[model samples]
Target: MEKSTNLSTCENVMTCPIRPIGSGNEHCPYDWLAVYDGRDEHSPLIGKFCGLGKFPFSIIGTSQYMYVEFVTSPAGPLLNTGFHFNVGNWPGHVETAGIKHGVCDWLLSSDSLKDSSASEGIFLSIAHWYPPNTSCSYHIKGHVGEIVRLYFPSFRINRIESPILKYEGDCGESLTIYDSDHADPARIIKTFCDTFSRPMEKVDFVSTSPSLYVQFDSKTGSYSGSSLYYWAHYDFFNNTRFGDPVPNTLCDEVMYAWKHPGGRLRSPLNSLIFKRTGGSDVRCQYKFVTDRRLYARAIIEVNSVSFKELPYNSNACTRCHEERVDKLVIWEERDKYQNNLACFCDNIPRAVRVISSADQMNLEMIVQGQHAITSYFKNPNPLFEATYEFAHGPLCGPITLGPSPDGELVFPYKKALAMVSGPMAPPEHHYRREKCIWELKVAAQRDLWLNLEKARFADRSCDSAKIEVYLAGRLEPRFVVCPENISLARDLPILTTAELGATGADQEPLPVLIQYTGDGQPGRNIFRLVWTELFHLPRNPDGSLAASLLQDGGCDFRCPGDTEVCIPKHLLCNGIPNCPNVTHTSTLSQLTRHIEWNLEQLGLLHHAGDYQQLVLHDESPEICLKRDLSELPYGKLSLIALGLCLMFALLFAILRRMCRSSSLHQGRHHLQEDY
Candidate 1:
């Protein structure tokens, strides 16, 4: 019976299935069946049935009638066994005959390494097939200085009882690799076999040369069993010498783009850039890992600096009306849009420093093409660069008390409150997230003053890294401060923070909580505060209550002319009576003049309109209220005035009776003592 066929002249290569040799009880010998391309006995062999050949083989040419012949001993009825073949589309090149995809050898180049909708890195994979006679070969080559690093995450080929112990000999149904541009057996690097003890083992290899050749051959011999196992998984990295990229992270990588030179591992500071001459989309991900308790900061120094396109006409106010050419996006997590930290593009170069809120950050850079192929080739322009590092900690100053020997505190004042830095520095390798909390206290009956002299934050705004001031026993904080207001400390004064005990109540010292966060940007994080323990000043001192209050310095604004009175700035012309007599101004001009001097003194000239309004009545609502009491009927106004007078008279009578009763009680107490 015919054993194998030759279809060398077939126009397209075909995939053929192998059939069992014979019926039950009949066993086939080793090398029982074989198939070749041409009828010429010297033509190269393609596959075989129980021999050193692979199941998936190429069939070539038409008009080349395939010949199948059995090879058996001259003694026993031609072995009474044979094989059959059927044809279909080839497995390796199905989508396109010549185009290679799905885990195949590829030529390394700048254009091929880039990720696109149609392809990825230079990767290859071989699936497990049951038939014993299955063999394949792959070839890879690249330019000079480019080395191939082959990594096999998974490898398993045929369930053989034992692997070939000899290093020089080939194993049964094994895969052979060579570090050469050709299929020269002398250049064999290693041979992998599937043994019972070590069924699967990851394999990694780096080619010393620029080319690599690999071939997988199956030779079942006489061991024809129903069950079989065969598979291999691998990928390649070029332009690098390191082998086996598995179980290793690239946290120390400084450059993520394809073309630019990367930074050294231990470098303290480094910059990353994105540039492309081929006008293709580029995508890369990087993870920042650190050991210290700190945060990270990334500053965009230059973005697309080489691109020189300007507005088309002079009428255009800005020259930034072009298409987006590049983007640098940062994420708190690996997934997109979940915790997107920020997105930097060409326009609106906010020059903002990005702070990582978490211990690790994921960054992705995508360089989009803005022009056509011809445009890019003639004038290729795309550039992006940024620098990143760990930020600094806050500055902790001293806390001094009022006239009480600088930093020392006596009894009742067990705890003294002052401004303290965020926390200690992070380790050398990497920085982590950190938080600090402080408790403040002051003397009894005295008020606590906290002044934030200087403040700097990880971000442009202090939202990510902020200080929360809360009163003791309060579920919510009384004040939440951010760095945006304090980013540039110009002439603006640090608003004074004061806490006083309730009137006539003997209570413990006040307690305030300040929580500081060092979220990544420690180099930029800074805060300085000064706290002073003030003495309790007399509110009504010798009929000079206002003057005493002014001396205490608690008031933000002090009324002129009547040097004896002081009032808060907000209470100025808000339909309230805080200042003494002759305060009513009939015209806007008169009102402005009356408060102009005091307003200027308090640096509140900007708020002149707040108190500049013409009114017919002695007292009117704030200038913004716009309600005129004179518009009301005269009788109605008279009635309202009369009601107010009657209410006051009733209140006075009640107060007089209470005073008389108190005096009578005191007299009785004194008489009892005398008796």
Candidate 2:
């Protein structure tokens, strides 16, 4: 039968309604019905069929013209029935045609059509018939920020059986879809075989990027008692409805918690328009970040979580221990790898709330099941939806505890009581990883004392709570104590600065830092510390009050000879004499006397000798005079002084006699010149 030009606008299929009596083999059949691609016997033979089989078998032709012939041998079976067939055409069917070099490859784009209404359409694997031993690829491209959505309304492929085993082998004919325009194995979104098409259910696929690739591969050229065909529709639309796209990423997104502070986060698989056909694993991360200075923590309330074929139960999180299971994992971005807050594999009915330890939180959905079916209908896709908000809670910043002499400090600071006591109180675990710091200043001339009144922890090992005391100008803590350290707690009333060997002589205010870190179980970890200031007076090592040595009130060193000048402790025994009463001639002796007395009074005389040696040498005039006066007897010292004076007088008389003789000689020389 030949179709006219007007009637040949679509593909033609011929159906036969008779079972010929012959072997089913096509090459050597006794009785058979022959079909051709053209109007005459000279055309290519499509297939020859003969056997007792179902009637009304159909064969689709490659074009409008087709030829058919019926033949029977004289020795054919007598039970053979006569054959008759009909030829018809589908009006609007589209066939898979090669676009380049006879290769079944096509590039389809949404931008090809200017009309918005015509941006989406349908195509089929076989408008007439798919060529055998051929592979066809369709690349669908869309605009930026747009993703491709494809749906298969009808799909069927012939199942190839093993020749030796006589059972189904690997799928010889398959349809595969890639998330990107390339047929890379890693980008493959889903693959369908005869087994997957047997259910006759509609399937959906979506691309994470702006392009998608669909490939149909038929490995064998012959038919296997079934028609291999599929019908699919594709559309391109913006993906902003789900979330803002993260740059340089396909499926990942960044939810704006810093600007909006409150919003919803949904898994990409949750969308009705897009569902993952699980052949490979998929991981998409949703991130929420806030300004940590304004918000202390981000709170996430999980509305629901669904995993393919995984039932909801109390142990859902625990049951997803295997790395291959579908799960939703949550954690703070700062500690993403180290600390995962929770993992869910099933729906959460109670709306579990999780608070991040810091300002940023991340939620990742992982779909790793090789055979899991992710659809919006019968088998729900792996999905999770959560609502998040940046929270500003009390006691999140540094605090100045006191100018008061004695006061007590309690952790959970008293103000946080309101957050924990009311009917709207959050669970105790919400406060996990709480950190607080308090500063206490020790007044001048006073010592700071810290007494740990109470230290309690839920875990007796005290790993949950940590208490540290840091002294001024120190990086390392002076005291690191936990509730479990009974011996350390009993040794409290610690002298904050003195324990570090700091003398309180300098009248500067000392700052003591107390930091408390809590493990968020309410009422389980508690810390109470009382600080007291004690009047401190510098004292001598000899059990005597060193204040007796001060001429001026609280002076460390005093000038001699009633000058009333006082020097600081650092100036005492220094090389330079700073005392006002001592003169340049007597400075050394006076400074030495005063410093020696002061050092002795302060019980630091042993330390004074080292400084005195640096300032004075034994051969110096002052030292020699002092030594002579001190070592000689009183009578010998006077005789030595008198004898030295008489020697000076004899030398002066001899110098006077020499000067008189020189004057008399000059007078005689002048008299001779006059004569």
Candidate 3:
């Protein structure tokens, strides 16, 4: 009773597990004498592969490359030889797999067809094995036809021209592509069609193999092509095709076609690049999907050009606060810091919303960089310096935002709540912070000395307060905060922001000016400086400060069901597609997400405490002193309702002086008659 066995090898190859009879082989009948490498692990003879002549083969895993490919040397003396699968270890092995880090199970390229004659009739060998994390199912005993192509560095190639195809919009059915290098002004091609217009079309239908959604956006699109759910007929102009690039391989997936919704999906060897600038008045469209299954589209017609106004070194803190911005808010951050104050090589999306005034709300915005996190609420301290940590590049290094691992001088938990200043209060006001510029000595006092005065509260605001000032910014480049107060808009009150209220309540103490910039010394964040307060103006009881405000036309409030929730996806979208209630050519509701500035001058969103627990963190100083003691309630019944109405008017004047002294003591009869 002696049966079980195993063994294997490579190099003139040999294998055996158990067999002996006329061994067969076309692919496998199994039989081959013996071979197994076991050098020592205390040798239990636990390794085997023995067979003779008749044929034997079995080495199911982890054995790659070292081929022989049915050799007997054809084309005279091994011509440029091929077949080399080098991996060793086999003997009663079943199947075990795992590997997924930079993938390379086994591959060696350069295989010139082995037999131009005995020149190199390499035997057969194409080994396989993969080990790491692990996953294996094993089947498809066989069926082959392969192709794969992948390219990206975020793409930007535009030509090579012709020969690979796939794409069909006009209700056909073909998609997938590649090919690039073409940029006829491809400045993001009018910012990808003005950032996909029609208020930024929100999505009628788009499924890129989302389990088969076919295609969509018909101006108002559909899915599975369409008849009720079909109509892939999109001809911005005779189907859609552009040029260049055609050498492909590796799991292809091109699918890019768009009337809007940011386009790009073409490749079959390509030549791509297009730039035309937004809200196209005359023409623009693009498409791609190639790797042979073809579909391409393009229609350019540009020169409309609408995108400019943004420069001051692309905004180093509002061009240094608009060169000492004196014009308090005349509205013009046009759409969230006006395309972020400048520098848009191209990416479109900040449309409209300008009107800003009051010398542009105190004006802020200055930049440089470093590394600052605590989720950065206010910055500008070396902005990750060292010769500008490679300067604000789309980069990835240098980061700084100064002192807060418990050092706390400013912001350990406040979060970037921005504040622009100068509520007209002149005579004296100053501030700089990174190098010291403190001038504002303000004194208004009374919220009962503000909970017993905390260092008279400097930059956290409010103490005696109406306004209070000491302003000047971008750190005056580095130091100095109060040297230019020409009576700062004479006397006070111009914080001015009336999109209908809340920007002035008898102004005075508001002389804010906290500009930052470092390397000017003390504490650092590489190269620091990022101010961004961007406008908040008001002053005009004669002290000057009204460069632009009386325009007043666009905002009376209204805009709701017109409930239109939150607009600003570029104005509510249009070029094509619409859904649930606007998302394509934009309808713009942005009264800016339910307005409530308990503070949030546009950093996005954040709020904490103290300003008296932030107006009593949701009220309860006894419900705001019982709603301010129900506003006067007759002054808590003013002294018993005025002492019961002055004791009923002093008892009616003592009953008219005792009834006129009893009518003159009864002599009234005689006196009446005589009268």
Candidate 4:
């Protein structure tokens, strides 16, 4: 098929001499080629082209397997004519996975324009022709946990010779992007048509999911060439959530530009000072929405927020009055004038209540900075810090997870147990500054057991500033623990244990609420909790294995060295010393020696930090500790003498061993002959 190799031009390097071939010629009337995405014929179909069209066409393929099938109508008559045309530069490489930099790895330094596909990096570009009344869709799936980012350097749709191309409504040609596989209209992240005036605004479209889909459509419009000059420069990055913050919308502006309509301004914007610029007023608006059923009672907590003073730009807020300027307003609804829930100016508010009945909330921070003629663009200092979350109930406070006290919780028993936020305790400093709550419900068959590894708090200060664990249907707490008291204990203390009856026992599932109250200390309160569901094993009268409860608790095999700790059956003979001294047999010693010997041979006798680094396969280690004897402070003669001594020693040993073996063999042979 006829195809354009160059990304910029459509003219071929070699053109047909403008002479028509004879009718009797057996050459194919149509010029066509099928290009695949991968290296070989088995690769996915990228596109199919016909005639001398699709010039300046851009197609990406893999390095080794990208195959091209050229089709001819009559098979082989024009073969004798030896007609050839120069195609443009080879198609660039496309990366489906792996790390990528800005530079294209497909371009070799020696052969700059070689026709080859790229086998490395995670960057891809797409520039294709959209035939009339036709639609082409592309689905790019990145490695697991990765998000795709597409950058459009140049975008044009339905370009003609007369009027300049510009973004117009209902354009005949359009390009749509989706964050997911299904291309529903509501799910359209961004739609492009015509063109942008401001250098295209460097629009970066990011996929919230690991997969991104792009569709190019043309509605039988008149155009000189292809409807779109859609060259996309894109890469894949690991996905992150709100807690991590770095990879979230607030941190990476381009990656999260499509979070709201028309993109968010100064995203990841938190605690930055605001100064008046020119004649425009400075106001920052942030709107957050939560699922109505999922987050019914939500609140935003802002601590230690105050508009005080700055060094040089102190005069920036000259126009803002202390009583009514540079303030933050919280709104329960979109109508800010009437639905303002709370406003804070020059002082921090404890907590701003978000409207529970609705699914959306708006936050607006205004800084009426005084216009300074000389100091115009000074960076603002941090204004405040806030966090939003849903509370279980009004009694448990806004920081607690789960519903209110009256809300029913049902947890089912499972074979495996897991913790949501991990078993490790949060930072002690944060515990003192904030109050946190957690609620857990165990299934009816669960026999829940709670253990505290460590707890530390104020020493005998007040009982009110402590942790309290409450069980459902009970007014008194099952356990009132002081972190300081627990810290003084020698061994871990079992906090509580609740056992539910068997099925159809008319028993309610266990519901537990854990709350930690701060003692107004910066770094004095901390605790860790680990809960396990115990299974009652039916042991025989002789105290042997229980047929029914075998492996119920996941630890079935007893350690040979120490029966005190039962290990998982899978851990037995898994190369790890699970049985302590009993498992540390000659096999362990031999494995250790082998590793050490390999390390010595590589001259990298440094202790192995990661076991994978110690394992030697086809790839050799880069670092070694071995030193060359020639580099030492010795003459050439000395080095030669040392080498000669070693050579003689080795030769003598080999001769002695060979002679002894030969003698033994001769003796045996002679005996056999005598017999």
lDDT of 2: 0.59
Candidate 3, 97-162: lDDT as tens digits: 222223222111112211122211111111222211222111101001111111111212111111
In order of appearance, the predictions have TM-scores of: 0.29, 0.33, 0.18, 0.30
lDDT of 4 by residue, 1-675 (tens): 223211112254254333222111132235445556566778665454443232342443334345666555444323223323332444544434432223222211111111224321233333332224555565655656656666666655445322112334455566777887657777788777644322243465777677777776656422123445555655554443233233323232111112321211221232211221334445655655544222333345555355644464444443332343556666666445446666666554354333322445555666555632122232243455666654222222232232211122111101111211236533434332234456565543334445554455556654535666676545466676664456433222222223232334335354566655555333344445444433333458897545665534444433222112333334333332322232333343332333443344334456444443332211222222122331255687799999999999999999999999999999999999999
- Each prediction's Cα lDDT score? 0.42, 0.59, 0.22, 0.43
- Cα deviation of 109 in candidate 2 (Å)? 1.3
- Tell me each candidate's RMSD, in Å, in order: 21.2, 21.2, 28.6, 35.2
Candidate 1 regions with alpha-carbon error over 4 angstroms: 1-35, 38-43, 47-90, 93-171, 175-192, 195-531, 538-675
> After aligning candidate 4 to the native by TM-score, how far in Å is the CA of 588 from where it should be?
87
Score residue 519 of candidate 3 by CA lDDT. 21
For TM-score, candidate 1 versus 4, the one ahead is: 4
Candidate 1, residue 624: how far the Cα is off, in Å: 49
Candidate 1 residue lDDT tens string, 1-675: 234322122244354334343311133443355444457545544334442223333333222444444564444232233345564432332121122433333333323443332222333333322234545566655456454545465444555532111122345556666888766888887776644324434445656666777665655422222112333332233334211222342212333222221231211111111123244554545545432222222222222223233354232223222335345566676344457766654444434444444335555554444342323222323334444443222221122224220122121111211112224433434433434444465444444434455565657765566666666545466666676655323222212223433334345444555555555333456566444443332355454333443453444433333222334444444443333332332234533344554545455466567665432121234322332332247898799999999999999999999999999999999999999
What order do candidates take by TM-score, descending? 2, 4, 1, 3
lDDT of 4 at 396: 28
- Candidates 2 and 4, the one with greater lDDT: 2
Candidate with top TM-score is 2
lDDT of 4 at 672: 100
